[model samples]
Target: MNPYFCVMPFFGAELSSNSNKITPCCLLKNNSNIDEIRQKMLDHQQPVECSVCWNLEQKNIKSDRQYKNEAFDFYLNKDIKSIEEDCKKGLYSEQIIKIYTSNLCNSTCVTCDSYSSSAWSSLKGIKEKKSIISISALAQLDYSNIKMLSFVGGEPLYEKINFDILNYLIKAGNTNCFISIVTNGSVKLNPDQLNILKKFQNLNICLSIDGIGKRFEYIRYPLKWDLLLKNIELFKSLNINLSVSYTISNLNLLYYSETIDWFNKQNLPYNHNIVKYPLHFSINSLPKEFKSLLSIEAKHLLRKHLPQDDAQFVFFVKELGLQDNLKNISIKDYMPEMYDLIQKNI
Candidate 1:
């Protein structure tokens, strides 16, 4: 058995308008490199395409590769030669599917871009359109045999296509398949939507929460903290598996200790990943002096995910100033401590 084997390259796929190539996962770049990735795994060699997982593993953090392999273990337990043959002969079907239907989100999060959120496009006056998935493209997939279906979006809860895909699975009598949705915990699910979701045997709702209270509202932008709390209670009432996905960036890393304590008090299942793109938002951009005051855990995280350049701090400050002006909001009002820290450093 290949100890480094991953099932995603051959048995999983991600559908999004962000790329034209067949992408096996959202963390991986959109490209037709699956064959290469698969062969590399077969040879017990790590492919650069799977660096996200390797990086996380190096930091002793659980990666998507580990989680996916475990989740799809039932399907991958067959003979290795048989699995290879099946894939080559087109007998193996896609059992894990991740779909990002459109960029039709309500809130414009600081870390997000116009490509992922319609609200960001509107705020920036970019005139971008929602990139909805085509019916023909969705029709190509065999949903009946699927073991897992994941949806993320402009906010999966707001995307009409997300529910449409759920309805498709329900109608196909594939309600037993695992369903995962990453939402912003902003939208309230309607009775009809709630009923549809209740029919699934395994449903995991992972909220994208970067910070808590006013800080959350500040980073997520225009999304009220009260609304998020109300929605969290609403999802809790559903008796489904709920979890939180926390992203640590320059905006929220300073508040990591408190936010994590809050998650612990709420007894919420949670996982965190550091922001690496838009290098300015990375924790590494923070001055050493500011970072010196961070919690031991936060400092450890910073070390794990080092910054490409500390100079990017200037860009983050500039961008925040521009956004504060446009939104008619002040970071000093929402995040006084962080504002004070930045002020002293710069």
Candidate 2:
């Protein structure tokens, strides 16, 4: 057996390296083949037991007093000190801190649950308000275990508050922590602002772009698509890891492939999210034709990208099944008010 195959045991999937059939470790009576074991390892790189099988095994073991005692002894004798140390180094190094610098935004996007016009209008009325975090407050934070600090808002670059906080973090020699910002990429960052971001090698930025050309304008509303592209190019030139976050909705459901192709050409990592039950409207707020298209695209993507043994993908598909029910129900059936809201806003 190849020495690399020895790593397989750590994954808890018992199968011969030659045959590639996997037997579920949770199964007390059955043996696994090598292929089944490989698939299980690919499902989750992390060590995890099959929840259903584990529960079943636990029940069976409890029925047998001798087996139950053996299981208890095995667990008690397991030396997990090395595993605990590795986890501490990788994940527990820091607590994540999120700073909401300001609620002000330049663009009024249609899908913005965070900052609708009504919400901003109310915030604007607060007298003597401090929109930005003070430099002193940021310096006071205990950075003992802060793995990352995220700056999020109506749009981090819409105002000077974000820059203030970012500058403080950089100057404080807190290079150990990763710094990230979620931006619309509309505001053209100055050279000084760009330099500040570049100082932190672990800094990352997420740009939200839903579609290409006019479709983006329609959904994002008031956001300049060209300016966003220009800013993304600027970030690329700086050698920053720029991620495009695309929120999949009925408006761009049919255009998923087109958008993915575009991102691929741009050499940018992209992620997609299905429209969830929003605070304002139900599935009825989405157009029927678009909703149906979204369902089809979502199913196709999941089946194509997800492996059979992936538990997370299985759960994801189950959730998509519920959303697919909108095919029989029109958006107007549940969200008539959304039409009026969109019309009034537009």
Candidate 3:
């Protein structure tokens, strides 16, 4: 068994920003690197293209590589040895599909951009809505061997292509297949959409929550805190699997402890993903003095992730100030403590 073996390269497909391109995983920067990653894993060499997972693993955090390998191990009833052999011989079947339908989303999140959110695109004067994935291209794949289908979008719930795929799966009698959607918790599922969702027995709804109350509103602008809670209750009523996808960023670092406490009190299970794009939003962008005021636990966790260069931190301050001005919202109002610390230092 190769320690670097991951099931993603052999058994999973991810839609890239381009409609026709499919890569091994979303974290893989270059689609062309997929084959190289597979070859490296088979040779027991760590692929540099998989730095996201490697960084997490180095930080003593479980990476997507580990989680996917574990999940597929159970699904296929195969150990690492058999999986490694299958890959070595170029024998494998796709069992997982992750699609990013389009950038048609409702909220312009602080950590998000025009590529993933239509709201952000509109704000930036980008017209011509387009799909990152081709629905017809997916139809060509064999659905029989599929064990998991995950969708992320501008907002999957609001994307018509998501329903198009779901309808296709339903027609193929693949309702028993595990389905997961990462949503922003802003859109309510209409009766028809709710009915379609109810057909799936294994549905995992992962809500993207960054902060609680006004902080959440500030980060996910044009979204009401009350609406999010109401929608959460609505999903919970379905009795399906629910989890939180909490994103960690410089803007939300100070609120982490309290926000996590909120999740714990609600008995919501969560997984945190460190933001890397829009480098200013990265936790590493926080000034040294601001970080010194964080709790010991937060400080320790921050140590796991690499710190950004000073230039990026300077960029972050400038970007936040610009956005806050444009949005007519003040970070000082939503995140007073961190704002004060930053003001004192920078």
Candidate 4:
């Protein structure tokens, strides 16, 4: 057996050890030769499955098979030793570590699955629970394997605790570690805070903005569009790498092109993703024209940045059409009850 194969369950291989049978998915053919599988796995250059894999798994059995295969290939070619070496160096590891700082957010966005009054109520008593990990614990972590440190939350910038943690990491002299923050861009980082972040050469900010002007403000309620724009400008002026992430939903589906055009005008890298409504909601109820617009935009974007990504974009467009008569109107004109459902989960 190849050394990489020693790590069983490569990507999507469902092995029923009791029966000694292997069910090959997209990553592996039903009767694929060992050499072919190994080569394909090597191409992925990583060990773990990403968000794409998770999204695919939630779809049909066919997608699960494809996801498994992709995962298997990723692990097969990952350089375990190199990752170990980087971690041991204690400077910067190639692996990405997402630290959930806190669940508190200032925004009451309708589509946010993490921000409800009840959710805030649940957190009230948990103050004594110590959700904030100690700085010493972070310093003692095995960084040799980590390539990036992502601070995610309901909103990381809302709390000082999250900033403190980030400050500690930067001071630790792990300059090689890439730091990423996923934020709503509502909170402004003061000059001192900005200076600390600037010390880390690899710091990147991903701002979540669903639409433009009133459309964005309506979906992400309690947030001012101008405030977000100001913060974005500040980040850009500081030479910080900034990206915009738009979560496509029924509320802003019609403004897909407008959203893209707006982000492009800002000269920021932007990505649009569909809202994965939880299991309770009917996927068939979503708007078809909205999905179609996203598919078209995705295809156009991929042509310039990721030629290979076009296939997946096409897949989603087709998936939307497969469902029964979902309304075909642009969502910008009307709000759906599904927005409330999303808020509850947030």
Candidate 5:
């Protein structure tokens, strides 16, 4: 087996939209000096900070780094050694910049908190100042061989700085690089923004919708269902390859069929990203016996509806088993529909 060497740093850098912290992936957050970080990347040493991928890899599961390796090969079309040599020196060369800094989201998703969403701060009585990654800050980075830049939010479209970055790239004539914007699909891009967005080498929009109809409104609280559907239709109308990011929790896991049917009808591709934070709202919070039953049922659904995802079935069970504590929430009060489904399954 090949050693776990992730060459992303040779070509990528993920930034905290709210802070100056930078790391290889969102799963790992580190405070090491930039020099040390670069050296570690060049060494191909799997640091402790990348435990998220490491854990998944230990279980023989594909990780973000694996996908990124394939992506690097396709996008850069350069040997890893050449990139490593550059990193070996103090100089930094970044191609993929995945930023999540704008705290200016309008909706307060049940799965997100104050740290990630400014709207959550106001709703929950926590206070936070809005932050933006100014063009000057980004300019400091070497964008010589840039291939992709991603903006994730609160909601990227809601912040003006995100638009500014788009304009910077377009004006700089860096239109051959891909741009990905992760949003709640509640906001629409204006004509001017859309015109420039279309100029990007490839513009991919990842819609973060947890459920549909009332279920969606509940999970992504304060969401306008009609507006969301309309927004999605607008992107699809452009023949854009829309991707769905479903954050599964016990609250909506039983509604698997509803989500599956919705995706099939729209012909939208999706991946399940189980919510493990705010433990009270996670599937791992369910009683072990309850989780066991859910595990069986979830696998059955996958087998019937998504046979290619046998590994995903194991993920659901393994993640639940790894969770140490269980703190039940008021599921019935929050989602009577899903609540009743669980009751029936009982």
Candidate 6:
């Protein structure tokens, strides 16, 4: 049976930087055998290359599949017959088009590498891979039915292409689309870009921040604490909807509660997606003692800030234990709480 007819499971696509090939999802690599994956998708069979979400499901983790599924179910005309016809017509009733084309960014974040950030290019000694969506290519794609256009980048604000696209869409009178961008919150949008942004029906900003003052600077690196705050206030003044993306990593594991409290005071909604890549950075890499202290702190914050899901407090320690056991370094030497918590928990 056609999955598109029902709640279509695999209707969305993500385009990566430097290579135009459509990927299974953002976390996975591009499908080398596009025709085969396309054929499997059309046949309502899950593509073999789409193991990222499949594995996530097996592990009982919420994957990118759920987010896209919700978008497709709500936006598309879900009458099974109409969707089936669209599928047979060889077109995706696409709900989201997540694009990442530029590696240009100001801060060379410790967790990121040259593949995603140009700032790390020289220091990383990796060959640059230049695969951006050109103007000629953008003009050829069909944006007629798409509902959401997500722009994620090395840093979206660092590239002129993002602003140009927004202006282009505004000029084209495409006001039905909901545009969202994930920025580092270090560079504020220019006056022209802000003015053009107001033309869209809706635009949302996800500020990528990891920690509180000193912790934040250490993790994101070279980004001044004051400047990041100034930029966040700048975005606030523009009167745009804002959300915080706190990537929970080992670098800031001890300060999650403080970071959440700071954003909570601003009445900003924040999400914590565990950092998986660069395994050493994952909170699971933290010493067991550090995780114990972090867990107690996170539990209280969850209760105080989000009483509805207080049970989620244990996620901190649970994730630490679940970490891939990469002990390349130890936090015990650095954190005083480690020595104290070790005695108590032990």
lDDT scores for all predictions? 0.82, 0.50, 0.81, 0.51, 0.65, 0.62
Model 6 lDDT per residue over 1-346, tens place:
4532222333555666666656535654543565566567667787666665665555554555555554454556465456555766776644567778588877766578677787767555567864476565566445665577788888887788888777666666776677778888887567787777777756778888887665566556557779878877877777778887778765566667777789899888766566655555544554443454565655332212332122232443343333212222233433344334534542
List, residue by residue over 1-346, the lDDT tens digit for candidate 3.
5779999988888774456677768777754567777888888899988888988888777788987887677766788788788878888877788888788888888887776788887777878465567657777767666888898888888887788788888888888788889998889778989999999988988889999998898889878899989988988898878888888888888888998899999888887788877778777777676777777656755754334545677888788888787677888887787678778866
Determine the C-alpha RMSD for candidate 6 after optimal superposition of all C-alphas: 8.2
In candidate 4, where is summed lDDT lowest over 10 consecutive residues? 9-18
Tens digit of per-residue lDDT, candidate 1, span 1-346:
5655777888887887565334777677756477788778877888898887888888887887878777676444665555655655656567899887788999988888898899999998998878887777789878788888888888889887788899999888999899999988899778989999999978988889889989999999999999989988887787888888998998888899998999999998777777988889877888777888998878877764344444788888888998898788999999999999888977
lDDT (Cα, 0-100) at 91 in candidate 3: 89
**lDDT at position 232, candidate 5:** 84
lDDT of 2 at 129: 34
TM per candidate: 0.92, 0.55, 0.91, 0.57, 0.76, 0.70
lDDT of 2 by residue, 214-313 (tens): 6666555567788888888888888888877777653355567778788899887665544543412222233333234354444343212222223332
**Candidate 4 lDDT tens digits, 38-95:** 3443444322333334343444212323422333234334454443233234322124
- Model 3 spans > 4 angstroms off: 17-19, 77-81, 303-308
Q: Report the alpha-carbon TM-score of model 3 versus the true structure.
A: 0.91
TM-score ranking from best candidate downward: 1, 3, 5, 6, 4, 2
Ranked candidates, highest lDDT first: 1, 3, 5, 6, 4, 2
Better of 2 and 4 by TM-score: 4
lDDT of 5 by residue, 1-346 (tens): 2354566655568877666666756665656454454566556666776665776566555566776666665666665555455556644466788877578898776667777778878866766777766555677655445687888987987877777777777767777777788888898678987776677757778888777887777667677789989988888777666877777775577666678689889887765565655555554444433444454445332212223233333443343233211212244545675555445543
Model 6 misplacement above 4 A: 1-10, 28-63, 71-91, 122-131, 296-346
Off by over 4 Å in 1: 30-32, 74-91, 304-308
